[model samples]
Target: MMFLVITVISTFVLSNESSRIPFLNGDNFSDWKDKILLTLGCMYLDLALYVDEPPEPTVKSSIAEKSSYDKWKRSNRLSLMLIKSHISQSIRGSIPPSDKIKNYMRTIEEQFVSSNKALASTLMNKLSGMKHNNSKSVREHIIEMRDIAARLKSLGIEIF
Candidate 1:
């Protein structure tokens, strides 16, 4: 009877001691939960950033290659632009215009304006340097011009 009592007491003491250790405390559990939540939140934000489809590859050198690349780029660009345009049109079509939609359209327009300016500058630079005799450089310049033209076309702006 004495031995049983001693054993029970010792077991209780050991358990209590172990539970008091910092590693086994309630604070550790809360810390772990916080870390897990932070990691998941970061992953969610990263996914949001890439929800849009990737831009199509644009570097190519042959007629077939150029055609395929241009087709893919144009398709992707059109898809993105259509998505934006549809959102704006839907807002304007509604009986009550949504401020949220109006703001979204404004943001999209601002982004497009800046992008167009950048593309125009790049095209002008490429055009200015057309005298290069290197086939590879000329091919790259043509591809750049094609991309700039496609981007402009997406914004309903024609580049002659």
Candidate 2:
């Protein structure tokens, strides 16, 4: 439902939306996913937390029960809109157009996010070998480390 609102509002505001709206580019899927999550947080959406799909109503279901089904469908539409609006054209072109948010999110995750095991191993190596060289100030080193930590945290891989 929120995505519906975002999309409607965006229609007016978006011309070269992808260019003007700052988001994760296709160059680094992991980075893009992390930034998008934070952006969602500001809007009170938690993509990280699991949300089970609403159960489909049966033929004998009451009117109110059927209404819940409609809401579920609407919610997924909103989710897809959010995902579509933020990605680069290069990435967007590859996405199979779908109404189900789960499918849209899953497809992107599988293709771009890569295997978490590999990402975690790579990040762990970076963390283990972290060093502060004399060429840069201590502040720069700390800031760089923070960036790494944030990335790790965003990907659900804890390095601490």
With a 3 Å backbone cut-off (N, CA, C), the pairs that clash in candidate 1 are: none
Superposition error at 28 for model 1 (Å): 48
TM-score of 2: 0.53
Best by TM-score: 2
Q: Residue by residue across 1-160, what tens digits does model 1's lDDT show? A: 9999976875565444333333212112233323333432332222222234234445546667665555444434433332233233433344232223233334544544555566657656665565656767777877877775665555455777
RMSD of each: 26.9, 6.3
lDDT of each: 0.44, 0.65
Instruction: Please write out the lDDT profile of model 2 over residues 1-160, one tens digit for every residue.
Output: 9999987765543343323445546435666666555544444343322455657899999988787667666556655666688877877887788667767777888776565556667777897798987889999988888887776776777656
Kindly report which residue stretches of model 2 are placed more than 4 angstroms away from their true locations once superposed: 1-62, 115-131
lDDT of 1 at 158: 71
